[model samples]
Every structure is written in structure tokens, then in C-alpha cells.
Target chain A: MSDLTEGPSGRRRGRPPRTESAGTRDRILSAAREEFSERGYEKTSVRGIAKAAGVDSALVHHYFGTKEQVFAAAIEVAFAPALNASEVIEHGPLDGVGERLTRFVLGVWENPTTRTPLLAIVRSAVNNDTAAAVFRRLIASQLLRRITARLDLPDAELRVELAAAQLVGCAMLRYVIKVEPLASEDVERIIARVAPVVQGHLTGP
Target chain B: MSDLTEGPSGRRRGRPPRTESAGTRDRILSAAREEFSERGYEKTSVRGIAKAAGVDSALVHHYFGTKEQVFAAAIEVAFAPALNASEVIEHGPLDGVGERLTRFVLGVWENPTTRTPLLAIVRSAVNNDTAAAVFRRLIASQLLRRITARLDLPDAELRVELAAAQLVGCAMLRYVIKVEPLASEDVERIIARVAPVVQGHLTGP
Candidate 1:
């Protein structure tokens, strides 16, 4: 067999163009995460991130248009796995929806990858109006709406929203503010304790 | 009988001191509230607050020291009147405690005087780490601790903290983010709906 490869124009060529572009994009995103996590959203500039990534500033712009978009991307990466929450909800018995929901949320917060970026987004939101607006939209659209849509009840919207209020509030106290006891408590213990109340909010009359 | 009066301080000096210093302090507090509410903590400078009150900047400093101190004082003014929350737990029928607690909390959030400064604090805390620290301390020491202490249950502390989480989270969604249904619903209806859950968390097994 003869060695052959495809190129931009269908003939054998150098390294694939798509892979190179993807690599550059990935490098920029990786650098953006580090910059954001280290210096926060406001302090980290595009040039600074590009410099750290060893890429031209214009290339950074070419990939992610603005600082906000960069931030949104970073947040998306952090929160991407979180979207799999639908499966958790879907597979669980509906009657114990509250317990399942609480466990899943607690698990996400307890996970290091989700926790760090979540804290970053929350901290930034606390300090910036623009950031808060973005954060709110992200939560509403990505998390709450999906969960609410999956609910199978008349007042599912209200129930889902209330359940959200409960989970978010718990996370705020436990993870963000690090309120004692709750923060240090075992995950199973917390899930066991809080599940019923959460379930009540979701499935109760 | 010569129609003469002795000053309490014994030397009737310079306009009799007017007990107006207290009035001036109140005026400064009012002005600080306006400033904090309108411009937020970081943007509202001491001079701006003093100017709003028609007083010299030095007077504001003399009355409240730093801007943080002014914020503390302003918060105290807004929250002091309402901190008698003990009465809600103590005087109300134990069975109705949840309803009462919810009503009281919602009432405070609905009030313009209380709500405006609170929104400012939330906004500042989201943006400034120092402000967040101060806010955390305020909530932990003044609000959470006090409310928790008033409860005499076995798990009073945990329950109270959870209750605080629920109340704070609801406020964050309804008042600060202005989420629908919650924002537009009748205050009594919300209280009736939410109080039992809070009450159950506090007193249930």
C-alpha cells in the first residue's frame, strides 16, 4: 500500500489545518482559565492571556471576540459537565426527585472542577453587575429551565424554582461562604437530611 | 422665679448644644443611606455623602469614621428596628412560627427603607471582597447568630442556619434578581407558601 493523506485541497499536505487551529483555540482557552482563576475577570486582559499562552494578541481576538466572551467560555467549560445533571434526574425514580436533585447538586459543588469555576463566577458576580447578569442568565437558561421543563406536575415551574432557591441557598452557605458544620458535614449525611425538604418542595402539595 | 433655667451641663454655652447632635447624627445616617443606595458602597465617597447631607466631609468622618464604618452604621440604622425578630419566634404560637417568620422576612424585604440598603450591600459584596467579608461577618454575627440563639431546639443552630439560607436565597432571587412569579406574587401568598418549609426545617424531626 502507498502512504497517502488528505490535505486542504484533498491532496497530501503538511499537518492538518483543522488540528492546528483547534490546538491554538484550546491553548488560548487553557490560558484564559488560568488567568481568570488567578487574577479574576476584571484584572485579566486579552493581551495578558495571549502573552501567557505564547500567542499573538490578534489571535486571541480571532478565537474569542471580547473579554466577556472569554469569560463566558471559561464559565461554559467549568459548567459543561454540570449539564449532565439531566441524566441524573432522568434515571432516578420520580418520587424521590427531591433527594436525587439535592444529591446531584451537592455532588457538583463538592467536585473540585465544578467548585472552583463556580466560585469564580459567583465571586465575580458579587462584584460586577455585568458579571451577575451573565451569571443569572446562565443559571436560568442552562440549569433551572431544563430542570423545570422535565418536571411532570401542574405547578412544576414554581416547584422547580423553589427547589432551586433551596439548593442555591445551601450551596451559597456551604461552599461559597463556607459556613461551618454544613461545609464540613459528610455528603451522604447532608443528602439524607436535606433530601426530604427538597423533595417536598418539588413533589409536595 | 426670675424665668431663668440652668443648663444641664451647668454652663449654657453656644446655642445650648441643642441635643441637635443626635439629630445631626440621624441626618447623616439618612444621607448615608441615600448615598449607599443610589451609588453603591464603592462609588459613594464620604465627601459625597456629607455633601448630600449639607454637612462638611469632616463631620461625616467624625460621626462614622471610615466609609466601612458609615456602611456599618447605615446598616445598623436599617436593621436595628427589625432585629427584634426574637419576638416573632417567642410570641407567636409555636404551630404558626413558620408563617410568622416568613411574613416578617418578606415584610422587611418589601419595605423600601430596608430593601434599598440591603440591595446595596448585596451588590457591593458581589463586587468587593472586603465588602463581602464585612457582609459575611454581619450576617454571621448579627443576623444568623441572633436568630439561631433565639431557637431552643436540639438542632437549633443547624436549623436556624438552614432557615437563614432559605430566607436569604429567596430574597436574592425575588428582590435582587427580580425573578418572576416570586417578584410579582402577593407577599402574603409567598409567606404562606414558604413559611411551613422553613418552620418544618426549624422544628421538624
Candidate 2:
């Protein structure tokens, strides 16, 4: 752990280095996600993110140019993992696609890490036009279109809408809207009941 | 039509009569609905509804008491028509219940009058807990439970939730979230594509 041992590429380091800088950026992003989720977009400030990340406000500003940019980055971080439904549809048997899709989507919301950013997005999308567009693109447009393209059925697009509606509606009721009975029902029970209905949307009789 | 004809019920017309008060109340309710629809709950006020109705703010309070009361009345007014789905389920064949239910619900949305207040409720429900509760009781509890009870299916309650998810999700996309493709697609196309899915929820394999 000497100065000479620190120079792997024979370049002297003045400060932490490139990898450390990237880590700092990630920390800032994580903090931004938390701040935005906890307080929403308008109420959260760059200073708050920096404070949470244990960095100066200027550093947060430098890492993420603006609040909107931070939001886009946070959304990407949140949704990119759950947006893999296209693959399940592309390779899996058509019959089980609904169950697979239902499990994947509900699983995302059930997890705290992913759900936090999504909650922030859904909450803001209620009143903010830009947020709504961001959400629509992330959900209905980006992820859903991929699944629909792979399906072979009459009015496949509309069928996919119906399928999406079932899941999204359940999510709204359970999470955002918080309707009773459905909201309190166990997750496995819900999946068992709803998965088939979603499948009906996919391969109709 | 003058005072000479007052012998009918011993009722003489003075200002505009009792019927005029009822008409004025309807006007205020209509105005409140419009204001709440255009601007969300927090943004709307009794003054705004009164202005929209072309009546004094005092009259709005006199009729509806408070903004909360106005919202409750507006929600009841909006949902009363669409709440007929239970009766359809009660009297009609169990198999065709899906088509009848889907058609009735979508038809209500197609009409501008019903859709306005519904759109307002859905939009507000996204972030506002009060609005969400009101919507839940109206659509999920008041209407769908009756159909669920008659189904005699296992997990009947969950089935109802699943059915509600499909319709509510589609409605959210079409009128509230305004997702593309599905939002712009014709109503009959939606019901045709979705009714089977709803039926599947009710009577699953």
C-alpha cells in the first residue's frame, strides 16, 4: 500500500481516480432516487441528494446536470431491470406467457428497491405531463410493445392492452390506489387468480 | 301559466319557485364536476365552481356545504349511471355477463358527460387518497361485488379484483393516462378484445 504500488498504469493520481469518481456518481444517483421517491420531484433539491450522499451540493450538480436529468437517470435505473419481458415473450411458450408476465411485473412492485423509484414516478405522473410521458414510455410503450410484437393472434395489440390493463389495474388498486380486500390479499393468491385471466388476453378461445 | 292558474296545488309562483332551486343546484353540481375535471381537487375551489356555474360562491356553499361534499356529490353523480353493471349481472345469463358488463362500462365512458367526472376522479385518485377511496367504493365495491357473488367461483373476490383490473386498467389508459394505440383505438374494438378476458376472470379453467 505504498505510493509506488498505487500506480498500476504508471500514472500518478492526484485525487481518488476514475473508478472512484464513477462510484461517487452512483452514490449520488442512489441518493437522488431516494430523495425523489421520498419527497417527489418538485420538493426535492440537488442539495438534498448531495447531503444524503455525503458530498457537496456542487458535486451533485456536476454529476447530474439538472433535476430532470436526474429523474430520467433514476427512472432508467429503476425500470431497466423490469423491462425484460420482451425476452420472456420471445422465447417462452405462448400459453405460460401471461403467468410469467404477471409474476415479473408484480415481483418488481413487491421489491422495495425498484418500487421506490416507480412509486415516485407513478405519484408524479398523476399531475405532471412530462412524468406521465416518461412512465408511459417506460411501461406501455417500451416494454409492452416488445411483448405484443412477439404475440401471434387476432387483434394482438388490443389483447395486449387488455393484458396490460389487468396487471396495471391491479397494481393501481393494490399500490397507488390502495383498494381494500385486493390490497390486503396475499400475493401468491392474487397471482394464481389473475395469471389465467391475463393468459386469456394473450391466446383467446 | 300565471297566478290565475295557481289553483292546481295552491302553489303560487313568487321568485322562480322550488323547481328553480333544484335547477340551480344541478347547475352548481355540473359546474363543480367540470372544475374538478379540468383542474384537480387541490387546485379546484368552491369559488371556481360557482364562477363556472355563474352563481355566487355563497350559493355553492349553501347547496353543497363544502368542497369535500361537492366532490362526493360529483363522484356519486358520475358513477350512478355506470353502477348499473350489477343489475345486468343479476338478471342476464352468466356467460354473457362479460359482454354485457364490458359494453355497459365502455359505453358510459364513450359518453362525454359521464366520462368527464370519471376522468376527474381517476386523475385525482392517482395521488390523492381520498379520491382513490371514493373510486374504489364506487367501482370495485358497489358494482363488481354483486357480480362476483353470483359467479359462485373459487376465490370469487380475487376474481372480481382481476376483472376490475382489466376494465379499470383499460379505462385508465384510454381516458386518464392516455397511452397510445389503445387510447386511440375504437371502443367496440376494446370491448370485443377485453370482454372474454373479463369472462375468463369470472369463470376460469
Candidate 3:
């Protein structure tokens, strides 16, 4: 889920240097997210994504190389905003880190547009091993570790995961499972209640 | 999952008057749990479960009626113990309820034998809509509501799900996803840290 400022578009291979390549790549990722979310990892085929993107299946294979690569790219793109928060929290006050982290994480899930791809990645990862691996690598390395590394406290990693557990557990119930009340509760109201515990985990005695 | 005292074995119907009916029923459920956990809802079939159980596929249908029913039974057996915690929490002091609830929940995941079936149900429910529905109903109604009903307070249900969100979220990361230090940290240490937050969620201002 790292944004990889190295620029994914710059790394394209075997394509004529046309301006539309980026457009096509973005379109493929968009289609893949939708199809993967709707049909899931096992059922979502490269051809299906291509068909949805209005491109040849071969073009998808050409751009992303494999379904797994496509999924990885989609996740990175979707989580780009949330990934930025890691940097924000890195420089923020230690005391405010929990609030910053909780707000940012839940904020991602709160946005309808972003929530689609985020939920797609989450649902796919929760069930599919490959997707789960992708998710684990991104969250553990890119997101969680980066945030924990900035905390000079003992069990920093454990604290980070506990904070993540609260946010993610809330997201799973509210977004994925759509459990009542929690699902329909006011976004800010839920955040107010959860942020303190997250803060406690981050900076408490 | 709380092992239901209602005795899933005694609930078997339409079988001939065989004394070993309980044993046979248990065998079928055991096989169904393994197969369903391995293959999930779509791929798992009654015939496959029967094969694993060393019985005729007809016997599986006779015992459980359908694949859905077989899965339902398997979940009931796995979650029965965790489910029973609802009653235990129901009578505990409102203030101590949070610790009691968190202890009981994490305790379930800590047990190796129970963790297998519980993990299967969690992973399956995350992906399959049908499985998620079944899980949502069981957790929300059986566990969350029963605990909330004891509170005698407004938004008691909301508080219950939030508490659940914390515990279930931690379980998903610590056990199901096995996400780093949280996964490997001392169980008691985690329970100590997490129980307070769960307590706060359950009984806080």
C-alpha cells in the first residue's frame, strides 16, 4: 500500500511511449478493483478486468503482468491517502499520534469513493491467501512499522497493532459486515469514542 | 465459540432409532467442520464431507439436511463456548463486565483446539456473503445483544458492538492474520492491555 513515489507509470515495459499509457493503466486498475471487489479474487479473471476496462485481455497482461500484480497496484493506489498519514504521524507530537492515526485510518473508510477500493482490498485480503499476504506486507511493513518506528516507547510495535486492531475491527464491523448501529452510527461519534482507547494504547502507562 | 448446552447432537432428526445416532451425528459434524474450514462454502459439498467422515454422502444429507445446515451446525459447535460467555457476562457486575468479557473472548482464541474452527469460521465469513450473514447474526444477537441487554442503558447495543469491535479486531490481527508482535506477544500481557479498553468501551462515560 506504499504509494511508491518511484512512480509506477515510469516503470512500464513493452509499451509504445504514448500519452494514453497512463490513462490505460489507471483504467485497468479501476476496472480490476471493481471486478475484484464484486466477484472476488478466485473468480475475477484478467479477461474480465480487461473487458470491464474496454481493453484487450492481452493489454492487461502486458501492463500488470499478472492478476496479483494488478491487485497489488490497486491496493497501493487505493491506500495512497492513508499511507500519507504515516508520514504525517511521523512528524506529529507523540501525544497526538493516536488521534492522528485513528482519525486518518477511519477517515479513509469514511469516504464513499475511497471506501470502495479499501473495502475491496480488505474483503479480498481477509479471504484470499495471496491477498492476505499483500495486505499483511503493506500494513506490517509500510504502515504499522513506519508508525511504530517513530515511537521510542517499549512494545511500540505491539501498541501500534493494538491501535490498528481497534480501527480495523471497527472498520470490519462497520464496513464489511455492516453490523447495525456500529454500521449506521455517526462517523464522528464513533471516532470520538474509539480515539481515546487508541490514544491510551499509544501513550498510556 | 461457546459450546451450546442445548446439545447439538440431540437435535438430530429423522434418523432411524439407532443408539449410535449421537456418535454418527458428531462424526458428520466433525467432518463437515474440517471440509468447510478447508474448502469454504462454495467448494465444500455434502459428498466431500461424507467422504471425509467415512460415511455415505446420503448420511450427511440425512444428518444435516443441506450443506448450509452442515455449516451452521459446525459453527454452532465451534462457537458454542464463546457464545456461553454472554450468559456469564450477563450476571457479572456492570463495572467488572468489561474485564470478564475481554478475558473470556481472548481466552477463546488462546485455546489451540478451539482456535482452528474459530479461525475457519472467521476467514470464511470474511469472504462469503452467506457466511458473513450467518456470523453477523450469531455474534450480534447471541453474544452482543445478550451482553448489552444487561446494561439497562441507552445505546447499550452500540456499546456492545464497539466492545466487540475492539476484541474481534484484536483477534483478527493477533490470531487470524497473525500480524507481528501482537501475534507473538504474551497472551496475558495482551489481555491485560486490551481488557481495560474493552472495559472502557463497555462501561465508560
Candidate 4:
């Protein structure tokens, strides 16, 4: 993926050439996430992100074109693991799709490293219209559409959304809302109880 | 009830008594809802709500003691219809509880009058910890506990939460995130597909 990191070098607009473009990009993304988390969407600015990343505003703009684009990229990287969930559904037997999908999605939330950024994204989306639009677009295009394609049913999109709703709600309660039992319950136990329901939504009659 | 409206009369310290006490309280609640919706949880103040209500800040405190109390009161009023959902489960046969519960909860969301305040409460909860705590406490005590009590299962609370997660997640997608076709799908159609999964969470073994 060095080419992916080095791809920006061609558009040199009097900027310094460095071998650490990938590192700089990652630094910018990490700063962006922190800025979004601490300041929220409406209050967070690209300049603020650059300051946090210890990079120039020009570098921030060079990598991610706009504020929404930066937010989208941050979300893309954070959700990269869970986005692989389409594969979990695709590769598995149709009958086992629910359990596999549920386990995989919840597993992503269960991990602290991924959960932090996901929390920031969900909170931002919940609070800001611009963030919500960006989030809706990305989720529909990246995650839901892939799942819909795999199902191959006329109402496959609806089915995928229903399944997604089930998992997303569970995560909200267990993590964001911190409601008891579910919040404090073991992940495996929750999986056992919720997997069947997810399966029913996805593949059941 | 008049008793509820007039309940504050006894504790009235130097406040003028009027027959329009209930009207005043309702007006305050209405204004509180608007303020919370506009300013969000953190920035919203009791003084701001009182200004919106055209009442004294002391009156806002008299009706609802703290900012959290004001928010709690608003939530109570907004969710009054939803809190009645326990009766939907309690007054029905056990076998059809899922459909009844799902339809009832989603129906609350379906109403614009109620949905507006609910949208405010949910957005606040997702974005603010104080709001989330108030939400969690009220939902568990007023709604989930009642459902758990009716179920009479050892794991009834967890079951209730799982069912809640399913519906809450669905609402987040359909209403909050506005992810389509789930966002635009017919409520009845969604109810038809999702009730069973809710049922599976609540009553299925």
C-alpha cells in the first residue's frame, strides 16, 4: 500500500517531498478523529484538525478535500473492520449468515480500539445533519449495498437494513446508552440470544 | 389528572395561586421541549427554558427542580404514549406480544406530534451523557421494567432490552439516520417483517 501513501506526491504544489507521507496521512486522520470526538461535528474545523495533527492546513486539504470528506475518510478507516462484515455474510452459508453477521458486527463494537471512533461517528451523526447525511451515504453505499447485493432478493435492501437496524440498536443500548444487563452482559451471551433474531430477519420466513 | 397538576400547589412558597396552573405547567413543558430541541442537552439551561416559556426561572425550577429534572419531565411527557406500551404487552395474550409491542412502539414514532419531541430526546441522549442517563433510567424504570415484570421470566429484563435494542436500532435507522428504503418503507411493511424478530427476542426460546 506504499503506492496508496505515495500517490499524493505527484501533485506537488511547492510542498516538501518526504518518504513519510503515509505516516503524515495517518497522523492527520488520527487528529481528525480526536477533533471530531472532542469538539463534535459543527464545532470541529479542518484548521483545528491540522493544529491537532501538527501539520499545515494545506496538508490537511491536500489529503482530504473538505470537512465532510475528512469526516468520511475518518469514518471509512474506523469502520474498515466492520465493513468487512459483508464478506462475513457473503462467504458464509445463507442459513448461517445471521449468526456470523451478528457476531462479526458486535465483535467490532466489543473491541475498544474500533468502538471509540465508532462512538464518535454515531454521536456526531446523531447530533448534526451534515454528519448524518455523510454517515447515511457512506453506510448505504459501503455496507448496506454490499450486503443487499449478496442477498439477491427483490427486497434484499430492506432485509439488509432490518438486519442492520437490529445490530445497530443493540450497539447503541450496550455501548452508547449503557443500559444495564445488555451493557454489562457478556458478549457471547448476547450473541446467543440476538443471533437468532438477526438470522430471522435476514434469511427466515 | 387535576391532582397531578395541582400537586405543586401545596409546596407553593410565595407563588400566586390561579385556576390556570395546569395550563401554565403545560406551557412550561411545551417550551422546555422546544428549548431542548433547539439548544441540545449541554447548552440548554433552565433560564433559557423559562425565557422560552415566558415564565420566571424560579417557576421552571418549581415545576422541575434542575436542568436534568426539566429534561426528565419533558421526556416523561413525550414518552407518555410509549410508556403505555407496557399495557399493550400486559393486556394482551403472550403469544402475540412481539407484534403488539413492535406496532405500539413504532406507532409512537409514527406520530409527528410525538416524534418531534422524541427525536429531540433521542438526539440529546445519543450526544450527551446526562441525557443518556436520564433516558436509561426512565426507560428502564417506566417502560422496560413494566415489560420485564409482565414477562415473568428469569431473564425477562435482558429479554426486554434485546427487544428494545431491536426496535431502537430500527428507529435509529428509519428516523434518526434516515437510511432508506428502511427510512421510506411503509410502517406496516416494516412492522410485518420486524415484529417476529422482536417476538423472537421477547418470547421465543
Best by lDDT: 4
How many Å off is the CA of A52 in candidate 2?
9.1
Looking at model 2 chain A, report the run of 10 residues with the lowest lDDT sum: A1-10
Extract clashing residue pairs from model 4: none
lDDT of 4: 0.84
* Candidate 4 per-residue C-alpha lDDT over A35-140 given as tens digits, one digit per residue, 9 for 90 to 100: 9988789899999999998877777877777999899888888778878998999896899998999899898898998888888889899888889999999888
Instruction: Give every collision pair in model 2.
Output: none
Q: Would candidate 4 be rated incorrect, acceptable, medium or high by CAPRI criteria?
A: medium
TM-score of chain A, cand. 1: 0.82
Candidate 2 is graded, for docking, as acceptable
Reference-based TM-score of each model: 0.75, 0.73, 0.79, 0.88
Q: For residues A1-205, what per-residue lDDT tens digits would candidate 1 score against the true structure?
A: 0111212334222223575566766777889888877766777899998998887776666666688877777777776766666666767687878887888888889988778876676666655566556666776778667777777777666666677677777887777655665667777877776788788887888
* lDDT by residue for model 3 (B11-56), tens: 5553434556667778888888888888877788888998898878
User: What local lDDT does model 3 show for residue A182?
Assistant: 88
Cα lDDT of model 4 by residue, B18-70, tens digit: 56766777888889888888878898999899888777887777766889988
* Predicted complex 1: DockQ: 0.30
lDDT of each: 0.71, 0.74, 0.79, 0.84
Please give the range of 10 consecutive residues that has the lowest summed lDDT in model 1 chain A. Answer: A1-10
Best by DockQ: 4
Where is model 2 more than 4 Å wrong at Cα?
Answer: A1-70, A87-94, A140-142, A145-159, A203-205, B1-24, B45-66, B145-157, B203-205
